[model samples]
Target chain A: MRSLTAPRRDPAPSRLSYRLQRLALTPMVRVAVRRGLPLLALLLVLAVLLGDADRRAVLTDRIADLRMQIQQRDEFMVHEIRIDGASDLVAAEIGRALALDLPVSSFDLDLEALYDGVARLDAVSRTDLRVRPGGVLEVRVVQRVPAAIWRGPTGLHLLDADGARVALLPRRADRPELPLLAGEGAERAVPEALRILDAARPIAGRIRGLTRMGERRWDVVLDNGQRILLPRADPVPALERVVALDAARDLLDRDVAAVDMRNPARPTLRLGAATALRLRNIKLTELGVD
Target chain B: MTDLYQSQRAMRAMRRAAMQRGVIAILDVGTSKIACLVLRFDGPDAFRPSEGVGPMAGQSAFRVIGAATTRSRGVRFGEVSAMQETERAIRTVVQAAQKAAQLRVDHVIACVAGGDPRSYGLAGQVELEQDHVSEQDVARVLAACDMPPIGEGREVLHAQPVNFALDHRSGLNDPRGQAGQMLACDMHLLTVDGTTLANLIHCVKRCDLELAGLASSAYVSGISSLVEDEQELGAACIDIGGGATGVSIFMKKHMIYADSVRLGGDHVTSDISKGLQVPLARAEWLKTRHGGVVATGMDDREMIELGGESGDWERDRRSASRAELIGIMRPRVEEILEEVRARLDAAGFDALRSQQIVLTGGTSQIPGLDGLAPRILGQQVRIGRPLRVSGLPEKATGAAFASAVGLCLFAANPQDEWWDFEIPMDRYPARSLRRAVKWFKDNW
Candidate 1:
C-alpha cells in the first residue's frame, strides 16, 4: 500500500512573484529603482533639512563660525608692521594713521583701507600695504622729498617738485638750502619760482627770495632791498638779464629801489628818496644853477 | 480558410516587429519540461563570412543570449491539462529566461508537440495571363489549389508552397519571370487540433506574451537535426519526446509531411514504474541513468540500486538488475519507434530520393538507441543532436533541445508560407480598394 504523505514542494514561483520578477527585470523600472531611488532619497533629505528657517539659520551660523575659527588661527595673525622708505616722522605718522593693534588677525586687517590711510599723510607720496607670511604686515612707502619752501600767511610749508605739500616748517632757516617762495598762490608756482632762483644763481649771494606779485609776476629781492620786477611770460629770462646787469655794472650795489622789466622791450629803475635828492643836487651843480 | 490566412499573416507581422526590435523568445512546451530560449537577432550584416565559410546553417543570424528550462507540471501528452499549473510553469521559465537575458521579451515563438498534427499535399494549375510569370501568377497558382476537407475542429499550422513547375518543365523551384503557358504548384499543409492551438495561444497570452509565430514540434525538430544535404535530398526526423513522438519527413528543404504519435518516453517510464513497483520519480531517474533498449549478458550482471523512500528499510534497500530495467523499457521504446514507422510509411517517405532518418529529442539519448533504431527505422537511422548555435549553454546542447534550437532558426529566417505571398487582387471582394485599383490599371 502507498504511504499517505503530502506531495513534494513545487519549485515554480507563484504567479505574483513571477510577475514581480519580470517587472524588476524591465530596464526602465530597474534603473528607476536602483539609481533614481537613492538620488531621490538624498534630495528628499536635503529638502527636509533646508525647508525650516530655523535650521537654515543654524546651518549658516555654523558655517560662519567655522570660517571665524579658521580666520582666528595664530598663523594668520599680523604681529609687527615694517614701514619701508619713510622717514622717522612719516613712519610714526603712518603708524598712527593706520591705528592697527599688533597681533591682530590678518584677515581682520583691510589692506586697501590701510593703504589709503597711510597715503593720506602729507609726507607719504605712494603707499603699498601687504600682510606678509609669519605674522608681519609690511607697509611699503615712497616718501615725498621737499623741493621748495613757501612762506604763506599761515606758516612756512615744504612743497615737493610737483607742488605737492610734504610738511610744514617752523622757520625759514629750517631748510636753508631750499629756495623760498612767498605770497599768495606761491605754492602752486613753486616750479617757476625755483626756475627763477636757478637763473639768479650769479647773484646768489645778494638774492634774498622771490615774491609773486599779483599772483602773476615775480619780484626777485636782493639782500640790499633792491627788487627786479620780471615779466610774467618769461620771468626766467628777465631774471637772467638782471643778473647780467648786476654782474657787469654793479647795478644791484647802487641805491635803486626797484628795476621794472615787466615789458621785455623796455626797462625802468626807481631810485630811493635820498638817492633821488642827491642825484638832483649833483645834476644842478653840473648845470651851474646852485 | 481566409480566417486562417489572416491569422497567419498577423503572426508573420508580429514576427517582423520582433525582428525589428532585435530580440525574440523561443518556447518549447514539451511534456517533460518546458524550455525557453532568448535569441538576440544581430541582423545579417553583424558578422562577416569567413573565406571558406557560409552562414553556418543559419545559426549565425542569431545568438542564444539566455536559456532556461523547468520541470513541466499540469501538462500531459504535451498539452496543458491543468491551466493554472501550466501558467505558473510558463511564468517561472519565462521570468528566469528574462532574468538571464536581462531583457523583457514581449514576443514569443512557440512550438507544440502533441497537437495530433496531420499533413496534406495540395496541387493546383493555372494559365499564365502574361507572357512571363509574375508574382501575381504565382499567387494565383497558389490560390488555385483546392482545400482538402480537413474535417471539423482542426486548424492549419503550416501551408508552404513546396514545388513550382512551369509547363513542359517540372521541378522548377521558381516560376517567376519564367516563360511558361501553364504554371503548376504543389503545397504542403499541416493541420492540428483547433482546441490544442487555442490552449497554447491562451497560455502564452496569460503570460503577457504575444504569440509571434507557431510551429509544429515535428517540423522544427527536423529542421534542427537534419543536415543540409539530407534536407536538400530527403529525410525523416523522429523526435522521441516525453509524452509524444514527433515524426516529420523533409524533402528539398521543406517539410513534406508531419505527424505525431501520442506515445513517448513518459509511457516507457510508466511501464518501468509499474514493472518494478517503483515510484514515477525513481523510474524516471532509472530511465535516464541506466535505461537501454538492448539488453545483453553484461546488463544482467549489472545491478542498480532501486532505493525507495518508504519507511520499511527492506523495501528501501531493494535493488534491480540493469537487464530487468531494460526489459521493462525496451518494449515501450519499440512501440514508440513502430508508431513512428507507421507514420513514416503512411506518409510515403520511402518514395523520396534519399531515405535518411534522424532520431532526436530527450529519449533518443538512450545508449543503445543507435543500435536498436536501425531495426525498426530504416538502415540509415542515426541518433542526432541539435545544430550548434552561438552562445548556447553547454548543458542545453543536447538532443532534447532540438526543437528549441530549430525555433531559433525559424525566428531568424522563416520559410515562405502561403500567407507570405500576396493574394491575387481579383480574389478579394469587390469592396476592397486593391480590386478597384487593379480594375483601373487594367482598363487604362
Candidate 2:
C-alpha cells in the first residue's frame, strides 16, 4: 500500500510533436463549431426579431390609446349651449351669468361651479345644465315668475309663488300688473299669500293688493277698494264667504269702505263714512252651498 | 400590579384569538343613551385586514342580530358619575340584547363619549436585517416607534399605522416583502382618560361580560355618517345628543381628531322651558313639534295651546304663537352650530381636500336646520342619517342611531385598536402617557 501511494515519473512530449497535436485539434474544433454555428445564429436572430415585434405591438397599442384619449378630449372641449323656458332671462344675460366664453362642452368647464354661479342669479329659480352626447350641452332655465310686488326697506321687488324675494323688478310701464304688498318683511309673506291666491284663483281678479302687517295679520284690498280683513284661523273660508256675499247682493256696488271678516262667525261692514252694518252667525250652508 | 398585568395580557390574547370567530358586540355608554349592538360576521369575505384600503369589508357582511337602547343613568358629560346606576343601565341593555340574539355573549367592545381624547402622529424608522423587508419588519418598525408617554391610568384607544415610507418613497400602503434596507412608519395614537376607560370596563365586567375592545363614540359616529368620499377627502361630523354635542374629524377613513361640546339638545329644551315659563315636558314637546330656525309669516298667528293643570285659568289655557317658539329655539340651535364651527376651525378643517360638515343625532332632525346651519358653519352642510343596516328595524335607522350603527360596523370589522398590538406592560413609555395625560388634565 505504501508503494502504491508513491509518485510516478511521466515522459515529456517534444516541442514539434506538441505543435503538431495543437494543429490537428484546431481542425476538429472548427468542424465541431461550424456544424452548429448556423443554428446558434438563427436562434439569436429569432429571439431578436420576437423581442422587437413584442415591443412594437406594445408601442402601437399605447399610441392608439393616446390618440383615442386626444380625440375624446377634443370632443369634450366643444360645448353646445341650449336654452329652454327663458321667459325673461335673456340669452346674453344667461351667458354672462354662466361666465363661459368657450363652448359649454369645453374640457376646462367646471359644471358644478357654473351651476352654482347661475343659481346665484336672483331671477333664476332653477337652473340645470348637462352635457349631451357628441359634446352638446343642454341648459334648462326656469325664471322665477313675479307672483306679487313687495314694497319694503329694500324697495320694490318681485316675489315668487313661494313668497321668496325673486328679484328687484325693473321699473317699466309694460311690466305685468302684479298685486302690491306692503309692510316690513312683506317679501317673506309672498309664499303664504300665494297659497291663498292659489285657493282663490276664481276671485283672484277681485284682489287689488295684499298687505302684510309685520307678518301678523293680512288685509286684502279688493278691486272695488273694499278692504277685507282675513281671519288668522281659516282665511280660505272667509275669502269664499266674501266672494259669496259679493255675488249675492252685488256688495261691490254698496258704499262700503271696509269689511272686517277676521271672525268667520260674524262679518262687520263699515259704510263709506256714515253707517256700519253687522252680520252674525253666517254659516257656510247659508252662503248657498250645494 | 402583576395580577392586573397578567389579566390584561390574558384579555388581549383572548381578543386576538376571537377575531376569526366573527360575532362581537359594541356598547356605547353615552351621556344620553346606552346602546348595544350584536354583529355577526359572515366570514372572511366581508373584510380583509389589509393596509391603506377602504373600510374593512365586514360591515356589509355582518347582520345586526340584536340591538337595545336605554336612557343613560349616572352619566354626565359622557363619564360615569354614579357607578351603581350606570352598572344597572348597562346590565339592562346588555341583557336585553343578549337575549334577543339568543346567544350568551361573554365579551363586549365598548365606546365612551368622554375621556378628553387627544391625537398624536408619531414617526419611526428601523433598518431591516435582510435586504427584503417582511411583515415582521413592519411590525418591528412600529414597535421601534418612540411611543410618547400616555400617563398612568390612561389607556390607548387607537394605535394604527396610517402610512409607511420605504427607502424614501412614502405613501406605500404595504411594505412587507419589499426589498428595502430602511422602513419608516407614521402612526396615529389616540389616548383616552384612564379612569373613564377603567370605569367602563368595570361596568361591563360587573354585568358578567369581558371587555374585548374600546373606541371613542365620536369616532364611530363619524364612521357611520361620513361617506367613503368624505372620509377619504376629509370632513367633520357633528353629533348632537341630549347632553353633549360630539365633534369628529375623518381623513383617509380614519378618525384623526375628536372632541365634544358639553352642551346639546337638552340645553335647548332648558332654554325653551325657562324662556316660556313652561314645564320641561311641555318645552320639549314644543321644541319637537313646531321648532324651526327660520320663521315664516304664518308663525305669528299660528298658536299652540299650553296644556297643563295650572290653577289659574289664564295659565292653564295660555297660548304662544309659533313665531315666539321659533324665537326661542333658533338662538340655541345657532349657538350649538357656532360652537361646533369654532371647534372645526380650531382643528384647521378648512385645509382639508373637501370641507364637508355633516350634522347628525337627534337634534339634527329639527326642521329648517339645514337652511340655518350653513349661516353659522360657513361651509357645505348636510343632515346625515346612518346608512341602513341589514336586519335592523326601520325605526332604528335614523340620524339618532348613527353611533349605534357605527358601533356595529366597528365590532364586525374593527380597525387596529391599541389592544391589537403587542405592547409590553412593563416597558410602557412614561413620556407618551404624560403628553396624553396633559390633554385630559388641562381639559378637565
Candidate 3:
C-alpha cells in the first residue's frame, strides 16, 4: 500500500473500477430487427392512402399520366375510321353520328360505345371495328334498306321489313315505293304488311298502305280511303280474298267506302255517305246497320 | 511450515496477477453488510501519480464498473459466525456485481474489520556487502527484524517496511543506488485471529472465487478516508460501521496502529428497538431518519412513526417523539464513539503533532456525526467519505464504501512488502516453528 501512496510514484490508480459497465443495446436492437424491405413498402403505401387530400389527388394524376403514356405509343394512335356497306350520304351521316376525333389514341376510345353511337343512325345495320397497322382505325358499317314507310302519331319513318329503322321521312309521298304502314304496332307488322301487299297486287294502284289495328290485324286502305279489315288469324288468306274480289268483281274499284273482312265466314262492305243515305231512304235498313 | 510459506508466496503471486489483469474486485465484509466493487485500472501510460488527482475524471483510467451490497447474514462484528450463511451472502453480492459488469471475476481482495488484529512495530539493520545500499541490503535489513510472539491461532496479516534508514542518515524513502555502509528499516506487522482468516479463505473458495488479497478494514478505511496531508503528518480514521467500529492511525502515509470495537450502529438500533417496543427494521429506520446526539426544545415537536408492519393497526400507527428517539439512540452512538476514542488514545494518537480524526462507513451517516465525533474522538474530527472514483455510481460513493474504494487504490499500486522481495532461503531462521522468520510471525 506504500507504493500506492508514494504520492508521485504511480499514477495508475486514476484509471479505476469499470467492471460493471453495461450497454443499453437490447432496446435499440428491438427497434432495428424486422423483416426488412416489404414492411417498409407496406408502410409507404399506407402512408399514401391515409395522407391528405392533395396526396391522393397527386397519385390519381400520376396514374392517369402513366395510362396516357402507354396509350399514346406511336403504334397505338388511331389515324382514320372507315365505314363499309353504306351510301356516301349515309356514310357521312354515320361519321357525324360517331363524332370521334381522328388521331385520338385507340386505347383512349371505347370501341363498343362508338359502335352503339354509330348504330343510333337509322341507316346503319351493323358495325365492326378494328385497329390496323400504321395507326389506322377501320370501322365497317352495314346500312339498313328501307322496306316500308311507317306513318304514326309521331310522324313517318322508313323501316326495314324486320322493324329496324331505315330512316325518318318528312312525308309518306317521299317514300311512295315503300308500302305505307301506319298505326301503333305498324313498325313491328312491317313484314306481314309486305306479305299482305303482295296478295293485293291486283289492286296495287288503289292501295294506299296498311294500318295495324289494335296491334293484331292489318287494315288495307285503298284509294278514296276505303278499308279492308283482315282477320287476326291468317290475315294473309283474308287479304287473298280481298285480292280475289278485286279481280272477280272490281270490288276495290267501286264507290265502296270500306270492306270488312274481319270474319272469314262473312265479308261486308259499307257504301259512300250519299249512297248510304239514299239506300236508307229506299228501306235498305235490313242490309246496313248504323 | 513449508506449506505456510507456499501460501504466502501464492498470495504475493496473486497480487502480481491482479496488477497484470488491470482490473480487480474489492469486497468489504462487515457485520451489517457486505459490499463488492469491480475496479478497472488505467494503463501504464495514463498513471501519473504527481497530480494527486483521484480517479474521478469522467474518462479516468480507474473506474467502478460494477457495485453490489447485500445485508450481511450470520455475521457479527465483521466476523463470520455461520460459514454457509456467510457464503450465501457473499455469493449474492459477487453474482450481482458480476451480472452488472456483464463479466465474471475469479479474484477478490476482501477487507475484514474483526479478527482482533494486533499491530507490532519493529526495527532491523544490516551491513551492506558494498558501500552502496541495494535492494538486497534492504531485504536483508527487513529480514533482520525480530518477530514477536503473537500467541496461538494468530497470523501476520501485513508485513511492510514503513520507513528505511541508512547509516547516519535516516528518513530514506528508497535506499537503492545510494552510498551507505549500513541499512536499517522500520517495519509494521499486523496479526489477526488465524481461524477467522481461515474461514474467510474457505468461504471465498466455496463461492468459487480465489482470495487474492486480504486487508484489515481499519487499515483501508484510514487510507481512503484520511486526507493526504493528515496521512503525511498523522491522523486516525474511525470507521463506525453497522456491527463494528474500525480505528487505524496513519503516519507518513502508512498505518502504524489499528484496532476494532465490537459494538456499533446495530447496538444503537437495538437500543431504539427495545426502548420503543418496535421491530428491529422499524427502529433502524427511525434511528437513521431521526437519530440525534443532541436534542433541543424543538425536538419534542418532531415525531417519528414507530409503527410495526405486523398488521396490527394500533401498533402500526404508534408514533414516538424525536427527542425520545434521540434519548434511545444517543447513548449507543456515544458508546461506539467512546470506544473508538479509547482505541485511539490507547494507540498514543494524542502524541502526534497533526492529530486529526476521520469518521467513515455506513453507520457514519448519522446526521450530526461530525459534530458528535469530535466531542468524543478529538477536537479535529471530521466525517469522511471515500474519494470519488470515476464512473462510481452515486449510490456507492458514500462513507459506506471507504474500505472498498481504498481497496481499489491499493489494487492499483500496492506498496512493496517484505514478501514482494526475494530473500535467500538460506537466511531463513533455523527454528521457524512457533514463529515465522524474524521478519514475519506465524502463531499457529
Candidate 4:
C-alpha cells in the first residue's frame, strides 16, 4: 500500500553525534587536538628512538664523527708553525715544550694550553699563539734579554731585570759582556744589582762585578779586588757617592783595600796591609819615635 | 503569584548575564517554521559617533551573526503537540545557526505564538505622600492595582506599565520627580496557559538551552512590523502565521493589548487540499505558488499543474487554474482576517487616534493580501516586513521573521515590567530586616 522506493531520511543528528560535534568545535578541545597532539607525538617518537643505551651511544658517536670531519677540513688543518723574536735554541725549546703533532687540525689544537706550554719556556718572556689564515700556528715570542748573569754555587745562570731566571750558562766567560751577580739569592736582586752597576759607571773600566751580601745589600768589586760595601737601603745613591769620591780624589787608584759606605753617613776606607804599615811608620817618624 | 514574579526576575537576571557574555540566541517557535537567530551584542559603545549611526531603537546594540529556519514538525496551532518531534526540530535549527555562527549559544530568548494569550487592563491611583513623586511612589501605585481573577492554570507572561498620570494631567510617561498630589497608572498584563508555557520551557531545556526571556509572539511581531509613528499614534498588527493569527495593539510605543486567533494559513491549505483532492504537501505548494487573496480575470486562463506522487495516472496528472486555487484559499484567509478584526474591535482599536493595521508573518506573503486585508481590517491596512538588522541573511528578512527580529531588539533593550520594580514595602514580612531598616529611617 506504501511507496517504499524513496524513503524519507531524517536529517537530525543523533544525540551522541551532536554532542561529539560540539565537543570537537570547543575552542579548548580543538586547539588541544590541533597543536598539542602533534607536539606530543613528536616527543613520543623522540623518546622511543632515544630510549636504548646502544642507540644513544651510536648517536653520540655519529655526532663526534661529524665534528671530526668538519675539523679535518683543508682550511682548518694546521700545516706549519713559526716562532718569531727568539733564538734558534729557544725556538727549538718552545717547539719541544708545545709538543704538537704536525699537520694536526686547528680545531683539535687548544691554543690556550699550547700558549701556556710555550710561555713556560725559560728563554721566553712572553709568547702569543694564534692559528693564522694560511694553516700556520704563528708563535710570536719576545725573548728574555739577559739583564744580569748570576753566578751561583751550582752554575751560572742568566737573570732578567725583574729577577726572573732566564737560562743557565756553561761558564761566566761565555757571557762576559753581561754584568755578573753572585750570592745565595743573587738572582732575586738582579734589578738592584744592575742599578748599583749603573751608578758605579764612573769606575766602569775597573769594575769586575757585584755580589749580594746577606742577600740584602750589594758589594761592588773592581778588577783590582778592591770592594765597595754598599748600604742595604739607598744602595744606588751610596754607590754614586763612592764613585764621586773616587772620581774627585782618585780614591780607588790609591792602595785602598775597601770602601765601607754601609751606614751612608760615613765613608770609611781600609788601606792595604802593606800600605797600612807604611802609613804607621810615617806617623811614628812624624811623632819623633822611629 | 510571587513565585512567578521571582521567576520572571530570575529570567531578567539571566538575560543580563547573556548580554554580559555578548552572545545570545533568538528562537521563534511558530506553527509552520522554527527560526533561530544568533545575536552578538557589541554593546552601545562599540559604535563611533562619526559612523552616523545612533542607537536607533536599540537595533544598533546587537548584530545577527547566524540565522536558520526549518520546517516545524509535530506542532499545531503554534503549540507543540509532540514533545520529541518538536525537540528534534529545535535541535536541527539551533545546530544550523550555531554552525553558521561557529559559536556555542547557551542562553536563548524565545517567543511563543500559541498558548492562547489574553490581555487585561488595570488602573490604580494613590495620593502622593510628598509634593514630588519618587520611585517608591510609582511602585506603590503599581502595587495598589486591584488584582483580577486571571482564571486557574494560566500564568502572567508580561505585566507592563503602559501609562502614568500626575494629578489631572494624563499621559505622563514618567511621573517620577514630578510635582503631583495624586498618581494614577495604567498597566497592561498579558497571560498565557500555564501548561503550554511550561511545555515550551521543558522543550527548550531538552534542547540544552537556557530560556533567558519569554515573550508573546503577538507583542514582538507588533514591535518589529509597526513603524515608530504608527506605534506612537496607536496601531494594530495582524500577524498571519501558519496555524494562528496573532493580533496586538500598540499605543505610545507600548503594547496595550494582545490576542491570538486559532485560524491561520494552514486552514487555507487544508481547504485547498480538500477542494482539489490533493496531498497536503501538494496543496501547500499550490497555495504558495499560485495562491492570491484577490483573484483576477487573467487568473482563470493560467493553468497550474498540481503535481503528485500518487501512482494512479489520473491522481498524478492533475491540473487546476490559478483562479480555482485562489478561490479555495480566499475564504479561509478572510476568515482569519475577520477573526483578527473582531479581536481588534473588542480591544477598542477603533477608539484610537490611528486605525493603522499592519499584516505580517508567513501567510502575509500571499499575493494581493494588501487588497483583501483593508476590506476586513479597515481601509488603512498594509502588509509589513520585519525591520532590517545588521548581518541578517537576505532570506531571513521576510515578514515571517518579524517575531525573530523583534526578539533581537527585545534582548538588547527590554521594556520595564512590574517585577523590574521593587516590591512595595508593606508587602514585605513584618519582621523583615529591610522593613526594620525602613522603620529606622522614617522615625529617625
In terms of DockQ, the best-performing candidate is 1
Candidate 3 lDDT by residue in tens digits, A61-148: 9999999899898888888876677799998897887788788988788888887888677787887877788877777877788888
Q: Worst ten-residue run, lDDT, model 1 chain B? A: B46-55
Residue pairs of candidate 1 with colliding backbone atoms: none
Off by over 4 Å in 1: A1-5, A64-290, B44-55, B170-181, B312-314, B430-444
Query: Which candidate tops TM-score?
Result: 4
lDDT of 1 by residue, A164-200 (tens): 9999899889789987888778888888888888898
TM-score of each: 0.70, 0.53, 0.58, 0.73
User: How many collisions between residues are there in candidate 2?
Assistant: 14
Per-model DockQ: 0.52, 0.00, 0.01, 0.32
CAPRI quality of model 4: acceptable
Query: What local lDDT score does residue A290 receive in model 4, on the 0 to 100 scale?
Result: 60
Off by over 4 Å in 3: A1-290, B1-5, B42-61, B428-444
Candidates 2 and 3 compared by TM-score, better number: 3
Error of 1 at A191 (Å): 27
Which ranges in model 2 have alpha carbons more than 4 Å from their true place? A1-290, B1-23, B44-57, B149-153, B309-314, B422-444
Alpha carbon deviation, residue A229, candidate 3 (Å): 99
In Å, residue B189's CA in model 4 sits off its true spot by 1.7
| Candidate with more favorable, higher lDDT: 3 or 4 | 4
B66-150: candidate 1 lDDT, tens digit per residue: 9999998788998888888888889889988998998989899999998789999999999999989999999999999999999
Order by lDDT, highest first: 1, 4, 3, 2
